[model samples]
Target chain A: MSDAKKFMYINRKAPYGTIYAWESLEVVLIGAAFEQDVSVTFMDDGVYQLTKGQDTTGIGMKNFSPTYSALGDFEVTKIYVEKESLEERGLSLDDLQHLVWEDEDEDYAEKDSIRLVSRAELADVLAGQDVLFNF
Target chain B: MKLTIQVNEGPYQHQSADTAYHFAKAALEKGHEIFRIFFYHDGVNNGTRLTTPPQDDRNIVRRWSELAEAHNIDMVLCVAAAQRRGIVDDGEAERNGKDATNIAPGFRISGLGQLVEGGIESDRLIVFGD
Candidate 1:
């Protein structure tokens, strides 16, 4: 109920087609522009948002993933990913140009911040935040 | 934890609604209070009362209604998006000269400010999109 000093933005969709991904990114940028402590996490198909070498020119849309790299410049550097998602999609940290933490450890389930987490761990993440915004 | 869920995708068109449903149910089951479920952009389609999927398939519209009815969850459909898409209540439908209003009963037509309020009031304002 109080002012949001810390913000966590969850992105759950892929880029292109719809504008949800774009809007969510804009909101995070705005939050960071205001000096808020912003953390962004990509889940589900949203993992595609951070995939390297995206080519949207053929689709008649501008490639926007590169803009995500600018988040670090805005001080919005805490980027998280669900480890299981990466494995399920055959994606590793090397496939992404951005900072990605894959919780490949068996003990990740026990340690709250040990890298990757289950969908259930999201509740804890949300519970600990002053603000949890998903897109 | 009190939370607000912002839905920005159409029902069944993507996994966004499913994610919202599971998360909402889990949040409620965990004794967390839900402040509201605000629909925007393509999400306004979720309030359509006339949707009829195959009998063998999932009926997301009905599922949403049941969730709202059971939990007393506030279901908000964006007024601007609804107007833009021609999804309206009886009055707006009449004024617009449309034959019928497709928005269901449990969901309400509201402004984007409500979403901002959700961000301000709830401990978490989760968005489901794309």
Candidate 2:
């Protein structure tokens, strides 16, 4: 197999209101099968995608918020949530879903899938990616 | 260096198509090769030849076609997205029982694999969207 390329999905839209967040997630799931170094960055309103207790019952739409938790199964473990976005929205790490994955190389220890980073730090991450999908 | 450009929004609705065009032109002028320009989501509308913009305005579709012709650039519209947005070529129009095919010149309908392949083949993949 060829060495994996760094693929980053930049999510800047909120879920439910538009199709971007949901469609972006679908691409990440499909792209994971390619075995690339896939990472998802949540910035701007995108940070709301990970907000816990998303109940779509009143919206008459299927709740797809749970899908974010399953991303670890596809080997998409690098989920970055922008600190500035969350703060601006009056949210914190505790308000988001706790995504975890098993590290087989580290004696099967469970590791947090989401990494909270500052805007400057996220800029560095963006610069390091080989491919960036913005939505 | 080889580069791939992805435009996610439609012309007039967003500046993605315009920005991507200038980026591609600048890259070509700098002696860089553009592996492909993949249109996804509403960006597929850019491949439709049916649009007749105002006489005074710049024709985005024509500009893209002319650029593709000038540089031999591969301009591909995502088949799935195009189908959803009613953008069709001769093959798709015939297959789907449509009367006319409106795909602009120099643009071809293709699968998402082309986007992935472009990412693999190109040194950089820049996405322009809303």
Candidate 3:
């Protein structure tokens, strides 16, 4: 665990319409077992995956939006949402889920995991990754 | 270099599978080691042994089976993805009550943890997606 590699799941597509979003989430959930330094990025249409009030009954599909909250429990504490992508799609931080994680080292202190960053900032983050699982 | 490949598209439906095959071949020809080739998403279709293409066409599924056999590559189709798309192995068929198994040779069904392991152990983890 001390030598955990930086693993990032880059989401660029929307949910439901295609299998990419759901399958991408599936990969992330399963990858949690590795106990790596994991992060997820929501950009482009991927920003829509974190929106609230998802109703998939009409689409005859399982609503997987709530799974975002469980990511914190998987030890994936970094969830990056690009500010430019949100603004381009007429969205703000308020439109997304308020995801948080608990720090066991600090007596389980609750901490916000959703980190809002500019496109440039996200680029820097992407560059620092040891492994990037693109979706 | 030790490499791993994740194919996210099915054979013929998209160029991803084809490109990944070529890339793996090129790498092997250059004396590179393929740690694993984990198929996910629609890529599970690559493992089905039921495919039958025209005689003149390149048999994509067979191509993969042959490649893996030749290189002794660990070619895996994600269990969840394969189950969703109806790609079944003998063990999976018995477990899921499926009458038949469609998984090809040189391939096996496994969990997504395999993909994560590839990312951790390989020198590079390349993805071929839509």
Candidate 4:
């Protein structure tokens, strides 16, 4: 087993609706800053957070999606997505910028790198994690 | 694995129930355990049985009941939130002289301390919100 403990964060809601996602991200960032291994899985509407062309200016909210890419700079690189979520919303990996997405249907088990995982794989991911935080 | 879910939205008012159901189902499938599901703020609406959504739409109350029954999940609603929202059980309803009670079955009303305990006890604390 790796010495680094893994943390999984499952985000299902949209980013702007509430502060849950923001608060959760803050917590995770702090954890990563402390040198903990961290991973994030965005599903349902939460996937929108990873899309490249975020324009929150109209709503007067500062665009924070860019901060997501910065997570890699902090060595928190395990970002996952649900395949059904992408297809259900007619999205693809190209929609995201600066980050790689795991396509669940292509590799539900995530054998290679941080692959996309099905609903079934979600449990396995949750099981292996030392810390799992949902937002 | 012991999972603690933080619920922010009321039952049926948003996608909180569906998200919780998905997580509960996945956790059980993996043979893991759910430590607790802490309901807070607007999440206390999950206990209200007074909802009557359109027939075409999903029945959140029934969905939650089925999920809890099948997985034996511990579903707790915030008591303070419930009381503030006027959702009471038979005892509270009678004491307050309400004509009817809105709290749903299989949902226990309790305090936020339970939520804090849940956060501390569980291996993972997942939050489902709007």
Q: Model 2 interface RMSD, in angstroms? A: 1.7
Ranking by DockQ: 3, 2, 1, 4
Interface RMSD of 1: 3.5
In model 4, state the lDDT of residue A32.
65
| Cα lDDT for residue B104, candidate 1 | 84
The local distance difference test score of each candidate is 0.77, 0.90, 0.94, 0.71
Report the poorest 10 consecutive residues by lDDT, candidate 4 chain B.
B111-120
Q: Candidate 2's residue-wise lDDT over A44-76, tens digit each?
A: 999999889999999898788999999988998
List the candidate numbers ranked by TM-score, top first. 3, 2, 1, 4
> Model 4, A41-109: lDDT tens per residue?
888987777778889889998678877866755566687788789789998877866563344566733
Q: Which residue runs does candidate 2 get wrong by more than 4 Å?
A: A57-62, A104-110, B90-100
Report chain A TM-scores, every model.
0.77, 0.96, 0.96, 0.79
Better of 2 and 3 by DockQ: 3
As for TM-score, the candidate ahead, 1 or 2, is: 2
- Winner by DockQ: 3
- Per-candidate DockQ values are 0.21, 0.42, 0.72, 0.14
| Candidate 2 chain A weakest lDDT stretch, 10 residues | A23-32
